[model samples]
Target chain A: MVIPVRTRGTTEFQGKYPEEQFQFYFRQHWIRLFMPFARMILITAIIATMGYFLVELSFASGTGSRHIVIIMILLIFAIVQLEFLIHFYNHCLYMVVVTDRRIHRIKKTLFITDDQQSIDLWVIQDIVKSQHGIIQNTLRFGSLRVEAQESLLRLHFIPQVGKKYEELMHLREKARHWYIQHQSAHPSGSAPHPTT
Target chain B: MDLVYVILVALLIIAIEWVLWHLFVSKSKGLIFPLETDESSFRVATPIRLRLFAIAHTAFLLTLICSALLFRW
Candidate 1:
């Protein structure tokens, strides 16, 4: 039985391996979610206002089906909450997970698309961090573009991307060192594969 | 006639919710994003709160219809 290692990545993702060590698990900045969250709040406020007016109308008229109006409001609120939940789930599910040896770009849209690409750390040739706007510059959030031998992985609007870029560079060097040591230590067989 | 109308609307709501959930929620369960640069299992766990909230929401929808039927206003 492989005892699952305790890490943020493992809890967020399922089916863990004992050997897969985590370097960094990066999620999108909450700023990216602010618009959707604000929209939900605005919707809830509108529903609440409508509900209050409806209840008042019922009280004033005395024949306006009070319980029915209340129920309708609650139903609308519940449905909107469900929509927000779906939106939040989609946001949470999109992540860029960097393990010691692998960089996994995992994205799952709200029931629309799921695209996951894994690039070996050693294969990544270039990593660039770009912040385009004043808000991003002030907030220290930016996009990271990773160029590999075959594929490119981009993480956009992530927080403190400069730090993450540094971390990736450090991890890349470690991977290179490990790869070199493994190559020399093996020279033939005997040693197991450095990493799968 | 009102009761029939409420019941029909209730059923319609349920049918629409069923289709939407199936399309937007259930279909994503089978996907497991690969990690470890190899074929390692990385599954997204469906949040339990979503299921509970869905059940409560469905109950509320039914209650909305029931209230409409009972009040007759």
Candidate 2:
């Protein structure tokens, strides 16, 4: 995914409307990157050891094929390096954002594709948090399934799921209360659709 | 000798990194997120650890390139 680098103040995000109040956002847990990172390290170590031995053997034997063998080893090592870059880039680009009016999931890739899904807080029907396995339990990270009437937004490996879930519940209640009050005040053709 | 080839490979890696950075990172630099804060009593601090992790990963790649240079020499 596309790599983003910056930090600033405000709840503001891309595509935020003037009337919308910014809330908080979160990405998949850092723990989710552990497997790919560990795999890269393991492969790099193995390749380095083998490459060292092969380079030394070929060099000491005074063979003309030493340079080609070294180049091949370097090429293989480069592949592992590229793999690490891709994984980290993807991790940085995937995130879920919450606003007073809506909850949004943004997914962007490094090339030409990106996707965003937004669900109005008022339309949220239920939120279920799931933390399976000893690792997720001990690490305090899990998945949240936000069920709307017609759509479901499943946020996986959310860091601090428990705390965020509580905050989300509070925001949803606030949004619903605001919606009800607005509807009562308008009471006619002025009220906007809940899905809008 | 083989050192020239190693250096060429290193240059290739740096070129690839630079091109990728120019294409993706620079173009999307303005995409900023609001600071993590609390409205009432609860505040969620920005994901500083994640940013640090990203920095560390960049450092690791640079190290890999350096290591390749040293290993050949």
Candidate 3:
């Protein structure tokens, strides 16, 4: 039996193998990052102006927890950037790892949620791409549903859903051909067990 | 003391970073490409992003610790 053990970056990321190859990789829309980033900018600007005034006032009065206020500002600054960092970490981690052998939807999250689902590329039954709503249509990022016999995995907020759908179909065809070739190369019960 | 509280909070943030790294970065880091993950579809988000972030974050933590200790509040 060929068991799969976690081999650092290779196994988890559809790598660490001889035959597997990656086709495409993408994350959710850039808007997700942009939204938070814009917010951080706006908030930082407000905080900076407010901090300057508060500091001036505290200095004039000579009696205020000005140090604490500065501390609070630093804390707020860190928190804002921290949110972006967390988003970046999560965004990069949770991804669609499509290999020649299988389509791996690895949902790795930091906040106590880790979901990893994989289906053989040859077994993919249907791939549906949808772009609804004004934002989705105008921005051109939407969702993809890869349906199989046992389960249906939906990748939401993926940019270029149409392109991904087409790629999925192509990969499916390639996977089918690869499987056929592999099966033909090794006939049933013709070779040794688990040696290859 | 307030300084103690601030220190504790800063430490908490560090802990969170550590946890986040182990939980997500270890499993899904796509920064190095072949160095990090050799798979075809799996690529790190950006090569130097994690490095830059770590440097900036460490600087922030160090500053925060220094403030907490020096400010006495």
Candidate 4:
């Protein structure tokens, strides 16, 4: 007998990116997400393991006092798991997408949902890649700082993103050329638009 | 029983550390520093706090083992 499993709501980011317009979508490095909480998890795990032994020894000594240690260990493990889950969820929810038309920033949390911000290519004043230290230089990954007339957004700790700066600049140049052409053709439609 | 428990605890702690090192700190693209690069090289590298925490973790484990041994004897 074969058992059938139903899988619904399995769609992956439906129609999020138009395939024809945007050729590539680069995600922020995964390392950035994990680094924030790695030490916390490791320390908690170590403490929990030590607490286990301490509790065992206490019980063995006829003290009949294992409650406090056991509770503390459980609390530590629970907190670690909670932190890991929160970090994973936050990482998965926050995303940035670049297209020929505009750049999209999507930020979401469990309860709070933020609307996407679309920044046109022509308005992007500068794209800066800051790589400091021998590690960042040697690793070839650094932070990308995006500057626009209205706002400044810094994409932090993007690993293996050295090559992306050039690619983005190329894309932006192309977009700027297209915008200039569009403006020359349609004077009325080319009015400076404010991004909300 | 105590000796067996102590050994098991030690093994468990080692296993946990190994897993954490492999999953979080190991030189994957997921880690801040790629495994190939030295951690000290990056400016936005793993913080000094993490190194200190690692030291404290090691010390805690050693203390646990020593205490277990002293208690057992």
Candidate 5:
């Protein structure tokens, strides 16, 4: 049986020179979403059950306070729901994207913080990954540290770190090869210098 | 007080819906990544969870509004 080899797929992203091709991308681990989501669910359940009993008790007492209790329950529910939504949106906005030439970290929030960081892949000197604790090891998410010639890029809680690390290493080699080929072909042209 | 509650709930619904629609449905300028680049024609598919959350949030808001209105009546 002939198995096909995996190749870097072509993807396009905005805010890049026309030639830059997307190689891979990933975000923080699923734990980022799961923790907050689990907390929200727990709080919602507590509020729901307690609110149900409280409302029933208040209604039995033939008091007008039941309406107030209902309103309070609804308010708390809204707050919890909003918190979960915002958290999910914030999580979705933060991503690490690798292209043929550069690695980019895009971070944005719904209202506040917007930041993007990039480093050339060809200049990357080392890529190291560490998985601490049993949770990280079992879940297959960890941190990756990329040391470039000038800058150090640290990504925490990267999902599927093992696979991502291998892919990144492979891409780095391809990027370096591409950089060398372009530089040698156009020694005096607009090709990006390896030293710079 | 109940009138105030109704107004607040309505506002919450509107605000949540607006945020969700802007982030997911509308062309969001804040998003660094493009849905699809013009030249390459390659597109990033939105995560299924995100899409599902958007739908679920809208449905939840609709249900909340209906319940609030029914209670008020």
Candidate 6:
């Protein structure tokens, strides 16, 4: 069964044809990464309050340096905040775009920006979905492997990927058909092959 | 001694954050103009290292608060 492509809003492609383009979907890792920070905030608050009592107990027993303990707690709070910001930024680097022509994969790192790789739908031989580990199975998120001519690239940690796999396959089929038609019409001209 | 401890803690947090960013976040996968093509497609995921650091930082913050309460002049 094919999932009908719906036009949710009229922002980016109002006049350009709504059904033609859709919003890019990120892998579940993009969303799950925030879970740790959210959990940390709740956990840290509870621990900090408990630490106050623990400090009092230590002082009464005359066993611990109250000053050192207090400083350590403050440092912990700062570290948690920094971690959230870093994780947010790191998750931002992964991107996948499905255009009318092809699928584009982009990954960004610190010092240098990598070139984009586009895989024409016509060249895609197969779509493979592999899920390993308990969390992946339970969460229903895992990697979608795409096999193409020159190489194979995996789309990782896609949440509820069972549906996404079907969706991608449908899209790939559509792209392949489109390319074939375009090639027939302009037989002399060669399609722009994506650079690796 | 207190000042030195603060600096050391800050440096440690920064160092961890830097490593995670470089290793996972910033690893180049060959897409020069991804944002230009589709800004929303490229997004930052939750950083695991950063979360760990946050837990550590919370420990430090509690220490500071306690110090202020007990040893303030």
* Candidate 5 backbone overlaps, count: 0
Tell me how many clashing residue pairs each candidate has. Answer: 0, 2, 4, 4, 0, 48
Question: Which candidate wins on lDDT?
Answer: 5
Output the TM-score of candidate 5. 0.78
Give the TM-score, chain B only, in order for the candidates.
0.56, 0.46, 0.47, 0.48, 0.40, 0.42
Query: Candidate 3 lDDT, tens digit per residue, A58-168?
Result: 865553477777778777877887777777777666667666567777666667657777788777789888999998888878999888898888889887667777777
Model 2 lDDT tens row, B1-73: 4667556665766677666545545433423333443331112323464455545655666566556555663
* lDDT agreement with native, every candidate: 0.66, 0.68, 0.65, 0.56, 0.70, 0.57
Give the DockQ (2 decimals) of all models. Answer: 0.10, 0.20, 0.26, 0.03, 0.18, 0.13
When summed lDDT is taken over every stretch of 10 residues in candidate 3 chain A, the lowest stretch is A1-10
TM-score attained by chain A of model 6: 0.68
User: Poorest 10 consecutive residues of model 5 chain A by lDDT?
Assistant: A1-10
**Arrange candidates by lDDT, highest first: which order?**
5, 2, 1, 3, 6, 4
Q: What is the lDDT of residue A112 in candidate 5?
A: 79
Q: Give me the candidate number with maximum DockQ.
A: 3
- Model 5 chain A, TM-score vs. native: 0.85
Pairs that clash in candidate 4 = A31-B30, A135-B41, A135-B42, B27-B35
> Looking at candidate 1, what is the lDDT of residue A7?
41
For candidate 5, the lDDT comes to 0.70
Predictions: Cα RMSD each = 7.3, 6.0, 6.9, 13.1, 5.6, 8.5
Per-residue lDDT value at B59 in model 3? 70
Candidate 5 retains true contacts at a fraction of 0.02
Q: What local lDDT does model 1 show for residue B1?
A: 25
Ranking by DockQ: 3, 2, 5, 6, 1, 4
Candidate 1 vs candidate 2, DockQ winner: 2
